[model samples]
Target: MASTVLIFSASLIALFLFSLTGVNANAGSNVFSMQSYGARGDGLHDDTKALRDAWAAACSSAKPAVLLIPKGKKYLNRHTILSGPCKSNIVLMSNLMASPKRSDWSKETIRHWILISGVTSLTITGGGTIDGNGKIWWQNSCKTNSNLPCTEAPMALTLHACKNLKVEDLKVVNSQQIQISVEDCTDVKMSPVSITAPETSPNTDDIHITRSRDVQVMDCTIKTGDDCMSIQDRTENLHVNNMVCGPRHGISIGSLGDHNSEAHVSNVTVDNGRLYGTTNGARIKTWQGGKGSAKNIVFQNMKSAVEVSDVLFKNIRGTSASEEAIMLHCSSSVPCHGITLEYVKLTVKGGSNDVRSTCQNAEWKKSGSVSPQPCSFKN
Candidate 1:
């Protein structure tokens, strides 16, 4: 009886230790380990096949699965997809690094490094790093040198057509282009994520949201070459709060309606954010001769005339890199109205605190210690 009790206690202790490794406790023996599938994880060997095999086993399992790419080893994967409408909920805990050699990537996959699609009720929470190893691609870009041909570079992580997804506690860095692309997804939440790249790296946006709805991004730190977060056409019900953005373009609503295409983006909110040393604090850009409407947006910092209306900017205080701290460049074809600014303050960077405002085809109201004042409504 005493020996049986000691064995039982040891089993419980082992299970408790296993739970701390980020695998689901309910997953039990359904943990598909990449190493068990023959991944060397030595940073030199290609782990793509091992990773795919692990995913396939877990994705087909009738029980809840945890695809474990365990820690303390580096894994190199080529352009890979962990695609599924799996039988049960899945968790991917990984420390995946992309192959840096241009020869390793095929032309078809030059646009994406790691693609996760069609998955539902998925959780990707590992305090692991997804390194793009992008310097080789960046060196050959047209933006690096005009003499080079403009070619497509890969986004480090692309989550497409997924619903009820949660991605948290990951560090995604050094993509050849966009770091994280959330496209055609719904009910997604990303929090406490770190996305970073060199400011001189071209088009490396931290997070790009497009055609997704009911998405929330909270407690993120983004410093990148392009927009820290760019909300594109048809994205609605997005909430971004408690974010720190810097050293590039700040949060942007659009370069929407490009090529005369119809774009519609609405019901967006950004609150409790800070922007420092950015090219634009908060901006909206829609091309001329484009058809569509961007409305019902609230930006705490700060448009386009995709018919922008019913928007509010509250508690936006920052140092502007441009002399024109507030620019409301609305489209004349469809003017913007019902804009509000409250407790706004902006001063020129590396200069006197004085700044100016510019407005065209926009009507706005201002209150509560507004500096640089509202356009055509000076105190």
Candidate 2:
């Protein structure tokens, strides 16, 4: 604990020193305040333009700039972008307030309400909350009502093609779909954050990472309807630790091999996870008739996909009320192979007394007290 405090203190000191330097491209930090450019922050009228202007100035600034959204303020916005290849390092500190509403977003691209992209060496730190007003979207979702046509809803926050990114101390709630998504990026870190939504809110995963590499997720609490963390195709070298998940699906890897499409996902590690009131403890699900290699995945949830392969799970302890405590529903044609388990203990919840492991064409080298055991039978 002392060492952690010292490290944090040192980081603060370094940042403070950096802030005190004169504004220059290579040496100092500048501030671009949203209020100075005319942000109402009243939560009524849209402050999109003001925030955009602040972002524009910061993006083109000659020095490292802080695009600051002050505390105790609620900024309303429509679809927004903070794209960059700025002259120097950039910091985005905002209280992401509200997302723009839409009747139907079926025709739009996956552009989030707040999209951050094309930036290198960026820091995102804030103490404010992002309210995703997902009530209407949830009511109209096709997950519970199959009669309605399936359509794509926008994410609350998205980081696209960003390298060396840091997301710290943020609260995201009630997203229409995926709360936070990172795609096509590298060297990203996220920690000490909370993401939440109602258990009945469909398709609202806490964090979804796709086609990204060298990412770290730590000390996060996620309570949502879908997977706490969903790992998709082309994602490699990922690590998640000190995670708390509840009232949702546990950490999951892929519904890969979709449409008989080939996918590659590898090198993932999930350590020290706590799951409660979830549907599945740890899961790997894939679709049939698809071809690809999904090797070297380390750990955890639910969602549909094509193929699954090579993964390791270790040191995961939790309670599961669901009958299928650990689910490894793999494809028959391309059966899951090279799975490894160690130090995983999941006890049955409630008084039912029947908690089983379900494995369909799943294989793993097992160790420790993994409930229902590994690769033994399918329920």
Candidate No. with top TM-score: 1
TM-score for every candidate vs. truth?
0.74, 0.71
The regions of model 1 sitting more than 4 angstroms off are 1-23, 27-29, 301-379
Q: How much lDDT does candidate 1 score? A: 0.80
Per-residue lDDT of model 2, residues 222-256, tens digit only: 98889888888989999998887776577777777
Tens-digit per-residue lDDT, 1-379, candidate 1 = 0110010000000000012264454625478888899999788999999989999999998888888888878789998998989998888888888887888778888899899999998888878888898888888989999999999989999999999999878888888789999999999999889988898899898899999999999999898788888889999999998887776777888887778789899998987666645766676787877778888887763211134778889999889988889888876545677888889989999866778888888888887778887467532
Candidate 1 lands at a TM-score of 0.74
C-alpha lDDT score of every prediction, in listed order: 0.80, 0.74
Model 2: what TM-score? 0.71
Model 2 residue 155 CA deviation in Å? 0.4
Looking at model 2, residue 257 earns an lDDT score of 79
Candidate 2 deviant stretches above 4 angstroms: 1-27, 103-106, 109-111, 300-379
